[model samples]
Target: MAVVDGEGEAGLLELEDDEPLEDEPEESFDAEVPLAEEPESFGLASARASFR
Candidate 1:
């Protein structure tokens, strides 16, 4: 008959070959990426003039 020590020796050995700790750098966004500009048709200045 085998004895089981409550310390969980078998389970800990399975996770022994894991990855090491290290710092990962952040990702950068380039300014050259094109974005569409808003049109002047829905201008806020003209909308406020109508509310007064």
Candidate 2:
């Protein structure tokens, strides 16, 4: 019973930690993936052509 109670408390703490991560994925998807990809694609092509 004591071990079960300790595990339950740890699970609740993990849930609290995870709540913020759930919010961050939205910005990560938008800023890291799409936002980064679009500029890199266009800028890299322009840079390559300019270099050659």
Candidate 3:
């Protein structure tokens, strides 16, 4: 089994601080990429197949 740890909590705080600066743009790109996959998984199988 995998062990869950407090390191993730620390990382969350760091992200909350970084969010005020360049994190917005960085997250936007990251969000967009996953968003694209999400739609493909939901109903756009054709697009997902193309990407693969």
Candidate 4:
């Protein structure tokens, strides 16, 4: 069994002032690196293979 607490609510209130404005542009999750410049990382090759 687990105990419930009000501390979670308090922490949320503390962070509410730091939240981003709704109008700000959200970041894109797409590749930050250009296809030609991507480093020869291990899993990157397999991941790119699946995309095509």
RMSD of each: 14.1, 7.0, 8.5, 8.6
- Evaluated with TM-score, which candidate comes out highest? 2
lDDT digits (tens) for residues 1-52 of candidate 4: 1234856766666567446633332332234444435655646898889999
Residue 35 of model 4, lDDT score: 40
Q: Pairing residues by index, what is the TM-score of model 4?
A: 0.22
The weakest ten consecutive residues by lDDT in model 2 span: 1-10
Q: Which ten residues in a row have the lowest lDDT in candidate 3?
A: 1-10
Per-residue CA lDDT of candidate 2, range 4-52, in tens?
Answer: 5547787677778787889888877877787778898999999999999
- Please provide TM-scores, in order, for all candidate models, with all chains considered together: 0.21, 0.35, 0.31, 0.22
- Collision pairs in model 1: none
Summed over model 1, clashes come to: 0
Task: Sort by lDDT, best first.
Answer: 2, 3, 4, 1
Highest lDDT against the true fold, candidate:
2
lDDT of 3 at 42: 72
For each candidate, the alpha-carbon lDDT, in order, equals 0.41, 0.79, 0.73, 0.54
| Candidate 3: stretches off by over 4 Å | 1-23, 44-52
Off by over 4 Å in 4: 1-40
- For model 3, what is the error of residue 45's alpha carbon versus the real structure, in angstroms, after optimal superposition? 6.8
Model 1 stretches with alpha carbons more than 4 Å out: 1-42
